[model samples]
Target: MTAPHPQAARHVRAVAVQPHWSAQDFVTAAAFRRWMRAQLDMARPHLNENGVNLVVLTELNGLPLVMRGGAWALRLRTFERVALALFLARLPRTLPILLRERVSPVRALQLADIDANTDLYLTTCRDLAREYGVYLCCGSAPTPRYERRSARLCRQPGLLTNQTVLLDPNGDLIGVTDKVHLTPDEEAGGVDLTPGALGDLRVFPTPAGDLGVAISLDAFRADVIGTLAAQGCTVLLQPDANGAPWTAKEGLPPDPANLRDQPEAWLESSWQVTAQRQIPYAVNPMVVGNLLDLTFDGQSAITGPAEEAPAPRSYVLTAPRPGFLALAPWVTSGEPPALREAGRHRAALSGHPMENQYREATLHADLTLPPATRPAPPRTPHEDALHALLRGEARAARPGRWPWVLAALPLALLARPLWRRRRA
Candidate 1:
């Protein structure tokens, strides 16, 4: 049998989902099977595909087990507003909330008694990275802990969630950043869950290529995106939930319905497209759902650069499961696309039957670099007007160069009689 393609052979697609979860204190297997089926159905399109898709779901970061005659069962949870909540979320009262500002040592001792999933979640993510080329991170920075046991929680290996850049066979960055921001629920019980820490912008050295990565949801902010691009980041892989943060209306403040593109959470939870040179910029979002659990929403999507740029091409894509959005190698894409000033620049044309009939670019001495180190900025109003005048003068001086051959080519191909002249 043929060996599988080497790792990082091509683009990588991945996804993550956070199901709206209720506290569960039961160990019944039946309820778990129902939940598992629903999530699997939601991800079937991604799962059924031939290639590996990195699916990240909020349930067990790594699926647990199956029961009975080839039946599947799993327990899924939203990152606990409290860790104990992961298994006991349905009961909010049972969830730990501080009634008093301070607690006795006895209570503190009781808090420490709960089981922890820090290493479990962390290990699952690492395994997924190596196994699926898809990584799903459920829960967030804080997993909820009594204020006192917080230290122990951070001390555990799981307190810190990360996104390792994908590496090529040679250990180069495949282009994507690991999760940097930890949500409150993820860090609820312990650990420092806030966004923006040291090493937020980390570079991974891999044989595929070096990678520059950023994690927070806001890491895709206009400024942040620009900064990362400038810093030599090739891929921006970000994972987010799909429950809220969707758009419900247009041209208004946080659309009452849509949570994704609203104004309120623009900083932490939003995606937008910006073009620098008209190369297509697009933003695509993926929402994962549980067919077994219809109430469950989806997660993990790629919000590509907007498409209104110069090239007039689509920019967003998603697998939403072991899903990924990728740009083809620059060679296939032809020229280095950039955010160009809108004008008369031609859009990219591809693989037409007569594509060769068109012209290819030829180098010219006049194309030499300018004296200034920086590229020339767009022309100012005065410069623009002057350039327009010069263009008009040059056109007038040389008379138009109409392509008479274009007009005759159609006549020769059709070979139809001259309209009224031939009729007469």
Candidate 2:
């Protein structure tokens, strides 16, 4: 809870900004700062003009910031491009490396760098929220953190967690929601991730009513949406960083593809949840980028509630290129008049367990805040070179050390005859 409930005539303006990236974009932290600042600046005028009170950016939008390490990572070249792509493609294939203790140092160094950059990202978003005077759901990122010991089985003493953070206007931290469900590939990839529970609803109170967030594929789960709706949440924000091509069938209802690149299935999970909940839903997905050969598409949009009169579903605004912004004025209290239609009533009566489960967030304490800001230092060439050396060392330490084993073969053969003759 972070905003005061505005009475009649006041509206909550929500904006979803799509972020783009290329190989050149991840050169340095300053470059990332400039890129992020530019996007925020572009949305600022629109936010001000629209009298926006809440702003949301896409998931893992801050990932490029994590690339602000090492000359090897910064300098772009054809061979280096292929090498780096191969390296990234193999990052998730850590199971064998983990068992062999090969990539631990590399991941340790990289995780530290990513964690530092994530801190920078959080601080920047907090400042933006303060500057724009808007409640911001900053974004999500994968970060390694220490977990408290409990009776539960230890999956790995400590591991990385993909988390989404929230900040109120005036730059105060609110709630942090972790991804509950992980892809099977991620599980097998050796980066042990802790999955969140469905019963632990991360619902927060907002001036715009009760607001909830579901990261990436989690939004597609009917139970997740149902639980939130049952908790009386009206606004659902689903932030995504989908590298897969949009395989949603044209002129067909959308379905959730779980962030996998499925060719034949329509990604209808998020849309179906919105359609069922009859609530305002915003989907802000990453767009237009390549990390090596992995490409991301832009399809940011805000879908209105299901309406019987106009059509079977609510209005949808999708952004294709140069990014997109979907803005709409919202009343904090009461259901929209469009939901009063016969079709909506029928849908509601059809028994959705989440519909009207709890009271509104207005009844809770307002998420008041105080003033504070944190700024990060510039990336230096010395630092980059040092990190590059660390990366080199990591590459050399990979498992299946056939190079060392082969080099030792000649020395062992030469020594074997000498030891035998001496013994004879």
Best by lDDT: 2
lDDT of 2 by residue, 1-424 (tens): 8897554432566666666555556557676666666666656655645443666676666644434544464344332243334334334432233334333422332343443565566666766777778777776766443221221111222355566766677666556666776653223232234566676555666554356778766775677777777665556777766543232222211323333322112134455555554444544434434443343433455544444113332222221221112322111123334322212222212244432121111000111111111222232332232222222321111223223233222222111110000000
Q: lDDT per prediction?
A: 0.27, 0.45
The total number of steric clashes, by the backbone 3 Å criterion, in model 1 comes to 65
By summed lDDT, the worst window of 10 consecutive residues in model 1 runs over: 361-370
For model 2, the stretches where C-alpha displacement exceeds 4 angstroms are 1-10, 48-52, 74-110, 146-157, 190-192, 247-267, 307-424
Among the numbered candidates, top TM-score falls to 2
Off by over 4 Å in 1: 1-115, 127-192, 205-216, 220-227, 242-300, 303-424
Error of 1 at 270 (Å): 7.7
Q: What's the true lDDT of residue 215 in model 2?
A: 77
Error of 1 at 176 (Å): 12
Q: List the RMSD of every prediction in angstroms.
A: 28.3, 16.9
